[model samples]
Target chain A: MYLRGYVSSREFFEYNPPQKIQNLAIRDYCSSNKFNYLLSATEYSMKNSYLILDEFLKFRDGSDGLAFYSIFQLPLNFTLRQNIFDKILKKRKQLHFSLENLALKNKNDINLIHNLFFIKQSYQKCLSLTDIKQNLKL
Target chain B: MLNSTVLSKNFLSDGYLKIRPKNQKYLFEIQKIITNKISKTKLSKKNQISFLNNFHKFQNPSNLNDTRLKIYNYINSKSIFSKMYYEIVKEYLDILVGNELVMQNKINLSIQLPNDKSSILPMHSDTWSGDSPFEIVVWIPLVNCFKTKSMFILNPKESKHFYINYKKNSKKHDSKSLFNLYKSKFKWIDIKFGEVLIFNQCLPHGNVENITSETRWSLNCRFKSLFSPYGTKKIGEFFKPINIKPASVIGFNYNDPLAE
Candidate 1:
């Protein structure tokens, strides 16, 4: 239920998925992406994370992720996704993070462990192109 | 004196301005006149808000239009009404539009009741329907307006982008769909009784049904420079020169005595 799901399918985009879908997507994305680490870090960290994630979900190119970007590109075709991807990538590189140290400090946090599992599963699903390609036709 | 340069810049950037009126009494008097005209019995100033809010109870859709016209004509007939209207926003109008201006001969009153579908104004630009882009509308509310009771206008920058790509965006969508397309971009104006709004009528602006439990009463009149080029709403016919300067009067009266 990442933000990509909203723009992933033409039906969801046209009919507008219910708030339930939007909420689920946001929670799922936040839980999976270790968003809590950034949220608990500092206000600036939270804002930076939000900016990066929003840009990635909204403007990432099909070449990097899935082919759904090319199909759903019809409605918002004017946006140059590749250019946005490059800009976001440049910004992402500038952003420094010490995941190993942060993980050790927050090792006892149950929520972090749960979120990492969610991330692993969602990432695997994303890597499987057949599942998404089939779902797009529906 | 207000900074004309800053005010002009703000108007040009935002496409609208909400400023406190020069005289609050004028607005109260105008509201009183409207309330008296519409109410079957006399209503005190204290009951003005309730009377306006529950206006739908006074009349149904069948007689709404006739009642509206009656009130419109009566208000325009009062000599103090137009004068008061001008006084409310004359300072801003002088800076944004011009001192030598043509005002709409009749002021327009809009009444939107809660959950009423009959009075909704969908998203549209006045210029799209032959109104002059040179014209600016002076809008004043009789009651506090918020959320659905208030109107929405697309910001200048976003509106420009929408217009530039209109053909591509509109090819697959109708007006309603187009409204949904740029729904997030529209700014809902929250204004109170003592304030006046002078807006660029050329920008896309409109209101949905009054979902709130109140009737919305607002008056609007268009003003433009007297010498500015006219759209379908022409000079002398649709608009009359309200503030003619002395030099313009001399130029208007001057005639060349030739062979005749």
Candidate 2:
């Protein structure tokens, strides 16, 4: 199967792993899974820009599926994320997350991905709450 | 006589140094602070050593991480703690690394309970993550560490060999299997409370499960020369300028008039 790797230049929250490292991981993922790794589409560094992602979706027929560096690289906005999922599912294309070694195969996979996002959001909230409490102490 | 030449040669050859700090005052102070935090009731100076050694009796494996984090957060919050930490090893670092240094922002505390598999650090190099190769880790134990109670570091010569054949070996084995293959090449560190261990972070080093009867308590912090190259962890976010000379201070603020 042909897989187009997606590498994000934009920071996810406070961290952005080096782009070279992300691509290396994607390359390793492709080689291990026996996917013909095509050239990756680098996402724009600008906040809220998904122009490349939109282009990839429009012209995704060239590739069998898309591979992301990580699950967190997906759109944080719930509706935007859902739309991407819907489009991929409707087209019956596979989505691979290299860092997590997971693939979106069915509706259950979408639910699992949603739960992970929820967990991440809650973890961030808890950290912020702790920060606020510490600030109040001062 | 421990001259700079001798010190540098020994450090480079062995990839580590286990020596007593210039003074024990700051070490005693740091130990006292941790003892107060971990102990339910105040302990006298005489019983503190035994209490630390037998810390597993007080903290179980399940709640050990929470306790360790709480203590870590508390210590790192205090400016005095970092100041004292650096003061103890100032002379050694001045000789080994450089006079102008940048220290890691947060000092890490490791608490390994006896027979606890949960807290084991599998064999790996810090450089495998984002740590700079220029950095050196200053590890201070709160109790006597020997055998499985302490950490093991691969000999520098063996480390070079491992890295030379890294691609071939890594393809064949995971970290655990790799450690097993080269287990005999690693030297287990034997350090006491007042002594400090400064080791090359590029060398493969980590601790196994503490099979000894006592628990293990140690603190580790990284330092690199101010002008040295940085890895993924950049200066402002991960490191702070701890020691800077007057010339460097002026250089930082100096703006060239020739530039447009």
Candidate 3:
């Protein structure tokens, strides 16, 4: 089925249109696997800034490294953005690990927390890009 | 270094600089944009922090499933104001961090209340041990900032000493409250809306009580040199070649280049 009418149906969405949303893919990725926020962007620069933000926010729950990147990405002006980003990337994890293994970087080493149940678990052993996009609310 | 009136030496020595161009009409326009956005945002508790004289910021709710509001909600609308900011910041950053600079990576919104219980920052400098040299801050206030609700910035020369004295003072005073230690040793700067202040993160700074009724809004961003040291978060791209051009290219009014 096309599922076109399902989105607007009151039965389907008890809330309503204009509902507040979150990009859940990042949270799920971080929670269930050891995916790196740093590597994905270097490999792919999204024409859509929303996708990048949706993925990055999973770190905001609390991670020193993630906060730094958040500060760096601020668009006060381009140069400041670049400079902050420069500092953030100088510290990417060298190992290619799943999103689950990534950690926060404050004065103390923190265990990153992600309690999202992303779509990949029930359907397949690993996450699908399609499922990731849907969860990110993209 | 390039523009004579770009920043006064007094500002540099004081560890703070404010920039005001011949044409400052952009202030009123940006004020309208920010004000409208502020009205639409969720207001925080009336008494968020005791030490804060006053404060306000648009909260990007963590629970929001769609973050488009977070993205477009910034001051970077494609209007003339954004273009002007893009020009001014780009040039000044080149001067401060050298020619090799990146356009933008991140920005911040803050209304700091120094001694308020809601406040969380300990006395610390923007600069930590392994930071990149080019990293600096550009803070433009949406409202006039004065001694009352303003934040504190210790001179860079005195910051390191201040930090040491703070640590020592914290131990001697029987409390970790740095605010109590150097209450009188600090210098403060008062700013009006039509000004932009740039400071090196190495300088120690913090804001306490925002007792005023007016909500203090500041747009802040950090810039870095091409090869600056970034800690491990991994910002995607950096330093696109190098281009230093006329301010007008970014859409700033200027004295004629040919006239000089």
Candidate 4:
């Protein structure tokens, strides 16, 4: 019960529900339950979901986490979700391997830490999912 | 990507370039055409400059618009006018804008008489409206323009800084306020009869009321790369391809056989 909110729509339904079904379910759940609390929680989670690759990988790995969780909470179109899923999966593996090697080689470099922080902030502002969807529509 | 480094640097830094027209004959021809249309009589070459400079004396302020429109229509109706206009700035335009270009269909004529508040253009970038940033304007003055009779442009560096801070600054400042704030930073262009000024229309530029004694007579036209990204102005409506390379013509007409 405590981890139900963190479950991906795929695992929660035990079937690959179509995008329409997932969208309808999420909309219905929010309207019927504590709508304000759910909206705030979703907004907070979305603002901090900067590492899209990490989030996508965690969803794939079946992690019951809520700080930065599944894309299922947002009612994204089918093609957009599929496109984002493919891209994030590929980038996740590449970024993780490269960053891990760099961290091991330069453990005490303050410049690397500063660069990482800057990159993270820039990515957060640029890669917001709502913004991405709007751009895609345009 | 430009072949001339100095030209590129000067253009990028100053946001404008004023140079002597490549052919003075074509400029004179254009001036003759304009003078003929405006005066409705054969004016000698010696008096052409004086006549254009003192244009306000010929007509009342109320009839200025009608006279301007009539002259504009008469000049543009002649097929030789656009060709002559293009010839005046062909070299500079080839260096600044690309050789393959889309020229504006109708050239714009501006007649600013002394203390005419109705003819003032507010300070704003063409991009703020529907114009693409890739476009450049060729301004040709029929008479010597100086002091308040000339237009002003914000330098590229300061223009960039203003753009970056636009969201925060625009909340409190309107166009007039912004113009006042950056008045000292603007560069007033001084051009003569035999010269042409090509400027980046993406920068903030406009003119105040002509406070000088002489009237200002100028013609402006826009040109852009034939294949560059277009904003609100579509190809056939506002612009038309003036120079198309042979290869581009072939490519445009090529059709894939598999589609059928």
The segments of candidate 1 whose C-alpha lies over 4 angstroms from its true place after superposition are A1-138, B257-260
* Model-by-model DockQ, in order: 0.01, 0.02, 0.02, 0.01
RMSD of 2: 16.1
Give one digit per residue, the lDDT tens place, for model 1 in B1-260: 88899999999899899999768888898899999887878888779878998887777877788888889878877758888888888888889988988788678999888898989999999989888788999999999999999999998999999899898988989999999999999999999988888899989999998899888999999998776656676443356556767775555434458822
Q: Which ten residues in a row have the lowest lDDT in candidate 2 chain B?
A: B247-256
What local lDDT does model 2 show for residue B210?
Answer: 90
Which one wins on lDDT?
Answer: 2
Quote the positional error of residue B70 for candidate 4 in Å: 0.8
Candidate 2 Cα errors over 4 Å, as ranges? A1-138
**Cα lDDT over the full model 4:** 0.66
Quality of model 3 by C-alpha lDDT: 0.44
DockQ of 4: 0.01
Chain A TM-score of each candidate structure, as shown: 0.29, 0.89, 0.24, 0.22
Residue B234, model 2, lDDT: 49
Q: Give me the runs in candidate 4 sitting further than 4 Å from their true place.
A: A1-138, B1-3
In the order shown, the candidates' Cα RMSDs to the true structure are 27.8, 16.1, 18.8, 20.5
Tens digits of per-residue lDDT, candidate 3, B148-258, equal 456677785677677667656766674345666665766766887778888776776776665555545566766654334443312232222123234312332223478
Query: Which candidate, 1 or 3, has the higher lDDT?
Result: 1
TM-score of each: 0.64, 0.67, 0.49, 0.64
* Cα error of candidate 2 at position B252, Å: 1.4
Better of 3 and 4 by DockQ: 3
